[model samples]
Target: MSFDDDPGRGGGDPADDRFSTLGGTRQTRTRLPESTGDPYGSTRRPQRGSRSLVMVVGVVVLLVAAIAFANRGSDSGSSPDGQSPKKPDAQSTAASGTKPVGGKQGGIASGYAHDEQGAQSAASNYAVVLGSEGMFKSSTRADIVRATHDPAVVDGLLSRLDQAYTPSFFKNVGLNDDGSTPSGLTFVSRTVPVGTKVAQQDGASATVEAWCTGLVGLAGPGSTKPVTQTWFTITEKLKWVGGDWKITSSSQTQGPTPVSGDDRASTADEIAKAVQGYGGFTYAR
Candidate 1:
């Protein structure tokens, strides 16, 4: 569910595997390393600006866009491999032409329509907010919980996550004990949704899975947990409560991950600069 700064966890947060293929033999033909692992056995050392993160995010983005573009006047898009219809009618790849939300509640998107499209939108945006660096802080995390979760569950959820995002957790991710970024460094924890799928849905309840790639850790010179990317999927069970879709329960797993790429890694300065320069989008279907 959660990953730690320690690379030993084998979670593959980032750059965890460069310099692995220094020397190796090929049989009859040259074969690329397995998309999953480094040359150094099973563990991968995090590489700054790891190509895996960039490539995964890029591929997912392109795949989503291409599918949407291909499905443009149709009722719905096919699954990634074109094996099956992603959903029934009313399911779509384009916007619903209705406003995504009526307004913001505690700075989080709110008032999504009581429909499958609305559920997807709600899940996408919630994934971004929940995975943001802000969630590491107590005050901001509380606000996020109140804004996105069902009222009945807010208190309980906060109590649980408070224990989870403890000082030790913050420290592991390169944050100060108070969850603040150290001076001269930037903390990055952002989730960009690659796509959303409605796994199950009904009139008042739904389960949406957000396939996402995220950036975490610190970005600066000589940083220990240098900014790295991670691939993970967030599954949220939501209810159309009080005129809006709100999270009732949510959990994360490692990934519906793609194979690693062979692109050269960027420098820490480049990664930090890119994070600052590029503004994240308000994701939707």
Candidate 2:
């Protein structure tokens, strides 16, 4: 089951064709075939059975440990029936040893600083903020791009982002022509990550996935736009730049989301009006 605190409002997957493109956990730097796909017919071999047994036992142990850790909290993961609420699918990712950044103060967990989880967490949070409502306004954009993006990418990305946040895009998101709100309308575009993982990790870098759900739109009197949700993946190229793990580049993509439910839908006017009245939050894993 999907678990969004708001229980309302959403987006089709959006992507940034910038310095680096984003991808999901499935979008790994390398593709590995299942054990059943023994390209050389090695599956028939039995000489290495002893070694294989050791490996299998080790794997079982690790899986048990991981499940225990993840389930440590009442709010973590899903229940036995597999229907616990989670963050967006895009927020957790990894590529082997590499992990997403966990916190800003943790510094660059990249370059294999021995903190893969922290790195993945950092990347996920950065992606959420970069793809947030702040991206629409010039001032907020500057702050977000500066804070979340690497300096090397800031200048060029800012220019391109400005171009992308065109007047039409603003209108599409239920904002005014200038990307402002109507007197009473509240425009919302918020992304909250459910969890993060390192799909593939290396000493220097790891592919991180931030499985996320978002709310975007406007709410106010006479407004037609309503809040909606979406799922997507955000792939990032993280570098241990400066003293921290800065995002050298990133990109987005559509889900991997589930089919919509038959829940009663909210009216457009109500959605629009509600958007104007409610404020968004800073989501976490």
lDDT of each: 0.81, 0.63
Backbone collision count in every prediction? 8, 60
Kindly list the per-residue Cα lDDT of model 1 for residues 12-98, writing each as its tens digit. Answer: 522454422211211122234444544666543433333565688899999999998777757454566777664556644556676
Best by lDDT: 1
Runs off by more than 4 Å, candidate 2: 1-114, 266-285
lDDT of 2 by residue, 1-285 (tens): 222221121232222322221121122122234476667764432223334656899999999998987767645467667896655664323234433333443221223244566566576667667667777889788877777667888999989888988989887777878988778666777786755656666665566777777787765566677677889877777766665656777777888798999999787667766655765443322
Q: List pairs with backbone clashes in candidate 1.
A: 15-45, 15-46, 15-47, 16-44, 16-45, 16-46, 17-44, 17-45
Question: What TM-score quantifies how close candidate 1 is to the native fold?
Answer: 0.67
**Model 1 spans with C-alpha error above 4 angstroms:** 1-98
| Highest TM-score model number | 1
TM-score of 2: 0.56
